[model samples]
Target: MSLMTTLMLAGGLLLLNGAAAPAETRVDLALVLAVDASFSMEPDEQDLQRHGFAEAFQSPEVHRAIRQGMLGRIAVIYVEWAGAFDQEIIVPWTVIEQPADGPAFAERLLRNPVHRMGYTSISGVIDFGIQQLRHSGLQADRQVIDISGDGANNTGRTVTLARDEALAHDVTINGLPIMLKRPSSLWDIEDLDLYFRDCVIGGPGAFLVPVREKAQFVEAIKAKIIREITDRSNPRSLIQPAHDALPTNCLAGELRRHQPTAR
Candidate 1:
């Protein structure tokens, strides 16, 4: 059976297994926080990223944004990913409607140990995000995959194909390109933000915030979350239309990994 068919069957099974059909909760947004835990991310960077997210939820601004939403709530799941098949859901679907919900979610997120795995797979995470959104069992006004990574897609299916698939489903993808360290190795791309702009993020009002300094992590995460919750365009972010020309190579990560280097 096709993946879509399987998903439909699984959803049906949930209702059939229950005493009564569970009413799907309605929220302003259903968000997947798809984070990178690839080996390329140093231990310090990993900790910083984790704390950044945890703190973002605790911030008053994010809470205020949640309050101002049409339904005054959002459902979110936290996922850490690396390689084609390496994806772990650190925090399961949690609805954040009240002031206490955000902090509770953050605490649960921090309780999990941080881990790093092999390869960088933006495509893998996107595909995973799409599946999770479909199976989340929450009705949302908007669905988004908020991806933050230090590198590009080095494994799995083509990133653009996965991105296009998500766009077809009306799932918006936003990006956070971590550029703290200068690009010296082949694994690193100097124009990662551009790669995200031309390759990764898509759908309505998709944008990216490039993190070049260590100090910006907390603020960046908070700002991005607020913008997403409000579903508004931010002037400070690098907003790109879906049809923009590809200036940076979409296949740069794959090429760097597979093809032989020049003499």
Candidate 2:
């Protein structure tokens, strides 16, 4: 009854129910775009983030990256997550084979209204991403969860545990750590890049693009998407390395949130 065993049983069931199995779409990648809609992000910041992604998808570069893929297409889903139970799928799995598909995907994405909710559950988002991949009805060369967040996990299970589990299932977890401003809460960990590198991202070719300024958001997302679509091997040069000077406490958020206050 373990997670792995459960997943295996689910896969077996899918195979057994041949008539119920949806036709698997063969693509270069099966990607889950997990965006953060946590309370820490302001309305303006949320707008920026959403527009950045929408613009990236509609760009010529992303289109070219899709065409460069072996199958000339990729399946992607967009999920917005905030609290443990606040995960919502804004876009279901869609195949993008040609340049025209990019705008259509972007249109669908922009049509949805952004929702802001409490808590930052990195673990919840990763777990949700795993579930989406399992039901994606697409046989892809690479399975990736592209998670973008401005804060660390302060709710639900440990982020590292979810990350490790995803890696174990051959799923890569990449990150987009937004460090535009310091969170007002004491729970905010200053070294979010290190936290992401050590606890949030994993598996083959996993890398994070940290957005340090508002102006860089669009470009950062664009670059991240292109690299993901192309399946680049060494992304170290493209992303800033984890700050070795600042030791990352993976449990920093949890500890700060639950710490005993002045009596």
lDDT per prediction? Answer: 0.85, 0.83
Q: Which stretches of model 2 miss by more than 4 angstroms?
A: 1-22, 235-246, 260-263
Task: Give the per-residue lDDT digits (tens) of candidate 2, residues 1-263.
Answer: 67954564333222112122345868899888999998788899899999998999899999999998878888778888998888877766777876777788789789999988888899999998898888766798999999999888888999999999999999999999999987656767787887898889999989888898999999999989999999876724545564477657888878877877601
State which candidate has the highest lDDT.
1
Q: Looking at model 1, report the run of 10 residues with the lowest lDDT sum.
A: 12-21
C-alpha RMSD of each candidate structure in angstroms: 5.7, 6.2
Off by over 4 Å in 1: 1-23, 236-246, 260-263
Candidate 2's clash total is: 0
